[model samples]
Target: MQRPPLDPQLAITFFYYRDLPQAMRFYEEVLGLTLAIDQGWCKIYRICSGAHVGLVDETRGMNKWAADKPVQLCIRVSDVDGWFAYSQSKGLDGLSRLFENDQLGIRAFVFRDPEGYQIEIQSTTRTGA
Candidate 1:
């Protein structure tokens, strides 16, 4: 029998930012993520049921902010088109046209967050995808 992996209560991806207020506003107002925890310098927002994204103030965080952000935050939703329309209304930076990836079986679009971090909104196109 195969052994089971350790079960964690929550998952958080932390991103350090030079301007924490700008990052927080983008996540809260634009993305509509609810704040789960606030540690003064770090703020945790719930992305989904058990997933979270943590924004850290670079001055107080373990890591410093970098100009070239290589990480991308992706959210899988049921209504890609609706979300696209909403995103259009907001005039998000570096917004891309809605597209599909047959191999990945996803209908998606991407845009940059306030600090240039790429955020991908996608939905499964085919069953069992």
Candidate 2:
């Protein structure tokens, strides 16, 4: 089968919340993501080039918050230890000890945001040939 031509642009992962302001504060202050766009009831944050996260107010969104959050946002970084320490200093919830995963080729740790969203900070463990 012939593969379709790839013309990738921007990507946005959205999370629905009960309190938009609180989620905005966490993403802005704690995560240090810049607000790229605002749609009144929804706020979009830039994670990096071509990547963003949109926080939507539950009342205005199609879905509501679930007790069992099925999504885990993973951010690949150059310094996993540094980010782990920083999050530890901030007293972030569910902070896990940094561990290397041979299978995944990464060293990572997990933490929860104020709204119970799980975020994973990781660095590549494999060395280039």
Candidate 3:
């Protein structure tokens, strides 16, 4: 008897500022992610490890959330300091100051995207495991 092939899937979803194209540009151009696909209203971008981040239009008067709250997205990078420094040099707003936590052992920092969502960048070598 032949066995069926296994399948794996993982994705990160995010809300956009009523414009999917604008968000795509930000993620692709600013964040340096590649645009895998964009189906007009919906867009999916490649981040890493076969993982994708999707941008959906939630501002179309849908009951996605009661009120507009800040969304938190964490992006893991090889060089946390480089990314953080480069983002700052681009005049990007770092909402929260970078700090090291002995608990998680991760050197991390927070910044806001164009749509006002908070994104945290951290090192993969950290002892956050």
Candidate 4:
């Protein structure tokens, strides 16, 4: 008999933070993401149906927090302009103006979270983006 393919239940992208509470507040109040799982030092917020972002305490997590953040978290949304306006109103750090990339067929904006982690919000301008 043929075996079934590997199937994962959920996907989570983890980011380490020096202050978990501050990060939690940003994710909850600013991003409006619901807490799917709470493991004390590690908090998992649901981005969508199956996608999640885990905020881990650097002191307790496997990886330690660093000053420079080379990684960026990008979320695809239906309304890029609306999100940009909301982000500006919140006075987010390192916020970038909404711009479009014709080659990539996307309208996007970027901003840093409370702990300097860059987050990009974008929407597809054309099909199959």
Candidate 5:
């Protein structure tokens, strides 16, 4: 089998929402993602390096949000505890206590955006062998 030619520059994960402004505020103000591009109906935010997330207005978007959410955005950070504390202070919704997973080797917690998209902030747990 011949491999297909692939040249990837960047990656973006898009989420469709009915309320664009509310979604924007949650991502911009609460989550602190910087806006890299704004296409009027759709806004692109830089998550890190070459990773981005696009927020699209439902009327202008190709798809709509389903009741069953099939996606969860996970962000690896240096400080899970700091993010958890900041989220609590900001009164974010659907916050989970920081917990460790031995198999995954991470300490993490989850919270929901205004549109009910789950965002997980995690840090790797280092073990001295």
Candidate 6:
């Protein structure tokens, strides 16, 4: 008999930041993500779409862990302007510039998460991509 392969429903990455609680609060309270797991050492946050974001410690890691930049995480949202306004109100730093990329045909804005990581909120006119 043939068996179904194990499928991964979500994508996760270990994000190393200086402060964990602040990140947790930003993801949980500000972004309205549910706290799936909350231990002293690590935390797992789940957003409305069932995706997760993991926060990890940076102190014990190698010096390279404290790099100037990390990979950006693009989050798809229905309303980019609303979220941009909300992030601005929360004192989150966003890229001073905004533009439309003719190549990708996506409307997006870049903003920094609590740990200074880059995040993009994009939306499409169609119901689904």
> If ranked by lDDT, best first, what sequence of candidates would result?
1, 4, 2, 5, 3, 6
Candidate 2 deviation (Cα RMSD): 2.4
Candidate 4 structure quality by residue, lDDT tens digits, 64-86: 99999999999999989899999
Off by more than 4 A, model 2: 1-6
lDDT scores of the candidates, listed in order? 0.95, 0.91, 0.71, 0.94, 0.90, 0.70
What does candidate 5's lDDT look like per residue over 8-127, in tens digits?
Answer: 778999998889999999999988999999999999999999899999998888998666667999998887888989988988788988899998889999988888889999999975
Best candidate (score: lDDT): 1
Q: How does model 5 score by TM-score?
A: 0.92
In model 6, the Cα lDDT at residue 1 comes to 90
Higher-scoring candidate on TM-score, 1 or 3: 1
Summing lDDT over every window of 10 consecutive residues in candidate 1, give the lowest-scoring window: 61-70
Ranking, TM-score, top scorer first: 1, 4, 5, 2, 6, 3
- The Cα RMSD of model 4 versus the native structure comes to 2.2
- On TM-score, who's better, 1 or 2? 1
CA displacement after TM-score superposition, residue 44 of candidate 4 (Å): 0.3
**Worst window of 10 by summed lDDT in candidate 4:** 120-129
Report the error of model 6 at residue 3, Å.
13
Model 1 lDDT tens row, 1-129: 998998989999999998899999999999999999999999999999999999999999999888898999999999999999999999999999999999999999999988888999999989876
Q: In candidate 3, which residue pairs get closer than 3 Å at backbone N, Cα or C atoms, i.e. clash?
A: none
Q: Against the correct fold, how does model 2 do in TM-score?
A: 0.91
Pairs of colliding residues, candidate 5: none
Using Cα atoms with residue i matched to residue i, what is each candidate's TM-score against the true structure?
A: 0.94, 0.91, 0.77, 0.94, 0.92, 0.78
The CA lDDT at 1 in model 4 is 95
- Count of steric clashes across candidates, in order: 0, 0, 0, 0, 0, 0
Clashing pairs in 6: none
- Show where candidate 5 strays beyond 4 Å: 1-3, 127-129
Error at 62, model 3, angstroms: 6.4
